[model samples]
Target: MNKKYQVFISSTYDDLKEEREQVIKAVLEMGHIPVGMEMFSAGDEEQWKLIARQIEQTDYYVIIVGHRYGSETEDGISYTEKEYDYASSLGVPTLGFVISDDASWPSSRIDKSDKKLKKLEAFKSKVKSKLVHFWESKDDLHGKVSISLMKTMNLNPRIGWVRATDAPTTEATQELVRLSAENSTLRKKIEGFKTIEQPDEEKRLVHILDDNTRKFKVRRKSDKGRWDDAEKVRNTLLEIFLMIAPTLVNESSSKTIAKEIAFEHVGNNWFRTWPIGDNKIKGMIADLVALDLVQPSKKKHSVNDKEEYWSLTKLGNSILKRARRIQLEEGIDTLEDKSEEDF
Candidate 1:
């Protein structure tokens, strides 16, 4: 797995204890690490430092945004919000899971203080692209969250859930695939027709295409703003892998070692990418390999021989440690400022 797709889970303790646990379990089951306050010891500065470090090392920030975000904290800065701010500053991709009132809060009246509400509102506005809403009992939330995460990470969630029993079989899967291909073809034609009759709709489509194209190019360019930001995070994770290499290598394979580092700092999954150009992805891999931070693994014959595997090298480990340090420093700085403001 590449070191760039770590995920950090953030949430207020008051609202999402059991639910958080369940979410963490889901992440682990998906083969990613779950980083939360629970990963650290209680009331220990070292623990706080560790949490901050993990946050820095993470690739994706998963924040569980609930109603009572800041109410429980003496400083009035929800830990979740702090995490989000820190991740944002570091240019990490963030995802917010908003708990549905029907599931987490029985009423429309939120338990947050007025000041906290305003702060949360501002944060929400800032992170609109990375936010998603989920209800407790809604099975659809799983698919929605999965799809959103996959989109953010530039991955395809076509593998289906690990425990999914109702997975489409060979014939059904082929039929669905065929239908989807047909639908896409028809949609493209319809869109083309609409472009002629509806200038406004055509303009919207053009805008969307332009924006997505720009984003895609940004991801490819080494000096592009977003690409640079991602590079910073990638370097950080490489440093972390170095610090833990000795300990991890003794007990695990390179794949497991990379996975463990990703789980501890990012989320469970290590290899995730957005649905972008094949050439761009190949280029990104080449750059990482050239830097000596990542390497392609030996081919393994299994259910799928076409799938290529990659892992971190000793040099990559050093990079991850540096990245984790930066993340921790930024998180602590944000938390301190928020704490001072509360007083």
Candidate 2:
């Protein structure tokens, strides 16, 4: 899923303006939203409330520590420190960047007040308590920010925003909830019964896939070095579905599905191999949808990407589990015989 995360940037406004710009640029380049105190007037109770709310909504918190301690709140806490503390309290994933001790800096940007300098040192110490990067230059900071955020995001994913158009509709949401409840009931019932009769829906779907007349066509390189139609192959829908079902456990693009299908069905031993043609792939996907075996993925992706993403429906997963799970019986031959009879 291509999710756009919101990053809340915290730092002193004036001294680290250039650094802040770099961080914002990095965030934007990574296709995420960047928010900071630059948007609002500071040092007021109302403004702090608004800042707190914004921090709460943000997915990640990034703090840039420099020479200055920044202006303080009424409680003697610097605004930057307050933002960091609030974000930490809420358990937001934080990325801290502290200026290296050896960094060359102008005397004008350094903290002039003794009290503020002491607070600044304490704040830096607190920031260093966690995993952080030391940077001496804006460019250095930008690179580190991008790399760190990527790693953090991968290690710990967050619920991010999606376009309104891509979000599931009200009716779809309601249907999902209904189906979830039905699935739960069915599972409970299955647990209570040793051998439950197959539902008519499942039987019908299985029949559609099991039909021997259904065939998939492919093209292969000819002896003349041109593409030509290969002999039509007959693979039961159940077989094809089973081959590609695991990849669909997560939302996967059509390209990923094609690769999975090709790798499994089309042998690599062939001089040149091609995945199932797009049209045939689409037809197969549509068949699964008709059987309620798969559905369109609602996860967001980049706007530039045009590939269709798919995920297994509840029924699809249930069917897959039943088909692939090993039997409890210790008699392997007996279990194999029973499986063949059931199929």
- Candidate 1 per-residue lDDT over residues 1-343, each given as its tens digit: 1222456777666455766666666566556666777776534444556777887777677777666644333555655666677788887767767654446454443654677678877766665564354445424344334435544543322222233356567998899999999999999998888745644432332222223311122222232324334422222222333433433211222333333333333342223233133454455445556656567654354774454456556655554434434436434222234347868
Q: Tell me each candidate's TM-score.
A: 0.40, 0.53
* lDDT (tens digit, per residue) of candidate 2 on 27-109: 99889999998888876668978898999999999999999999887889999999999999999999999997778999999
Summing lDDT over every window of 10 consecutive residues in candidate 2, give the lowest-scoring window. 326-335
- The candidate that wins on TM-score is 2
Measured by C-alpha RMSD in angstroms, how accurate is candidate 2? 15.6
Query: Distance from true position, residue 132, model 1, in Å?
Result: 3.4
